[model samples]
Target: MKRLMLIGITVAALAGVAAAAPVSVEIATEPGLNVTAPQKWLQLFAEIGQTGVRIRGMRAGERPRLEELGGSRRVVGVLTRRGDLLLPGGKFRQRDRAALADYFDRVAKDGAEGVEAPRGRFDLTEKQFRTAYDALSEPLGFATKDQPPRAVVERVRDRLPIALEIDRAAERTLNNAGPLAEDLEPLTVGAALAVMLARDGLALTPEHPRGGEVRLRVAVAGDVADSWPVGYDPPASPRETAPVLFEFLSVEVEGFTLTEALDAITPRLGGLPVYWDHASIAEAGVDPASTQVRFERKRTYYKRLIDKLVFQARLKSRLRVDEAGTAFLWIGR
Candidate 1:
């Protein structure tokens, strides 16, 4: 009885040791392949495991070997035309194997565009490849809600120049009205304008300089603009400084009349008074309570919102600032 109990203790200790053992993955590389590529691929595997997985790279003529270590887990494989031949460690379950396979496939398809591998394989673009590599190595942990709206808009604006131009034009128009509307941030307004332009299937391409001035050509899905809003002209210049109403806002409405939309946003504008050019609206027969407006939950500026309202109502606005610094809106058809 004593001998049997001692033997059982020994077996239990061995099992514990095996469970705590480290896992390693070995990859064989072809000649002339970038050394860092293999390291990146290994890092991605480590990310999926949520642990530090060891990696070993073998050079050409070194036969790839995968063996079950007495007390450690390991993965062994090589990239091939058919796919990766992955051998998971003893600690890895069937589910883990599936997840690794799926991740590898995604990396190959989306990330590898012009990447050159050892076996004359060139599949991943440099950007795609780098992004894939960083996914495993660099983890972004911030929640989206914690991010500022203006920062988000700036990122989008940098990618689209036409969007920037549109925002500038809107700012100029709002500044012309003076104190009636609040100040506009180019990035925030640009992002909103970009979304609107995309919805209309419109794209703007700036033409080469002609006699010292540049003109923008509008295209709709690769075709010349045959139908667009009439009587639209680009604003002259964007204003640099003005009063700001709200720093950031996310508004969404559909099937709401222009007046109702304004009413809804008025409370959020820090009690800044709004005045409309009643005479111009009345003369043009524009009914503020009848025009429908729709906006999505994107970071927006007050001036950008006003620009949208005026465009939808088929009217123009002028800013009038009094000597007392009070701002008023004058609407014109």
Candidate 2:
């Protein structure tokens, strides 16, 4: 009877201890983004109770202020050019050489006091070029009536952006005469394409099937187990069910803008024939087969940009605007 009473008292004490103990648990999360991701991507993680910026993509670089946004919110991206897809010697021009030549000429002739100084490259006509040069040389320009003989003349190609250095690099890669692959430096993406082409044993040709011009429009969507991450690691799964998808949107055997063709097929993403607007893919990405991409304007002097974009899985998203500051950036599984 005495032992039983002691046991009862001990049980009561144990129950009290259990009741006083606190219960706690930790919740795990999906993988996030990398350091170079825009602040917006990181902010998403912050919203979801994570710290720092993490990223998952085709590649990541340690470049700060991508296109000069600011620290901690730089843009990290991949650049790809249209190559074998083009007919031999066929290329779309982005920089205007003539404009570049004339603009820099004025910079060399006139000092920094000149207001009409050129910035980078521009598209120009001969008449425009001549008129611009005349403005800088005239008295109304920078030089005085007495003319400053000692005025310093500096060359832009050598002084700023160092065009000569750039040209030398380009020349080295041009290869002059070699296999198309040898001549094509292909940049960073070539590594992957080379592997893919080799596996198929297929040699890409610049010539079109019809021996003319053709354009390809491509749309991309990335998914992740958890995209909004903090700090320097990549999303857990950069691989996706469909990381890349392409549509012929249009075909111009002579001259074409791939974007123009993409516009036509923009409405075909939904079930091929049925048109839909609203879609989602959990919290991850859009269904390329049924979605369109849009952009947001972050910098507007030349083009708009997106600070951050989020997409949901299975979402039939559309292009709100080509280069707007935001798009459907899918995150989370």
Best by lDDT: 1
Q: After aligning candidate 2 to the native by TM-score, how far in Å is the CA of 27 from where it should be? A: 57
Provide the global lDDT of candidate 2 against the true structure: 0.23
Candidate 1 has its poorest 10 consecutive residues by lDDT at: 113-122
lDDT of 1 at 93: 27
lDDT of 2 by residue, 157-228 (tens): 112211111122222322231222111111111121121122112211111111111111111112111111
Top candidate by TM-score = 1
Q: Model 1 segments beyond 4 Å from truth?
A: 1-242
Report every candidate's CA lDDT: 0.42, 0.23
Q: Which sections of candidate 2 miss by over 4 Å?
A: 1-185, 188-190, 194-285, 294-333
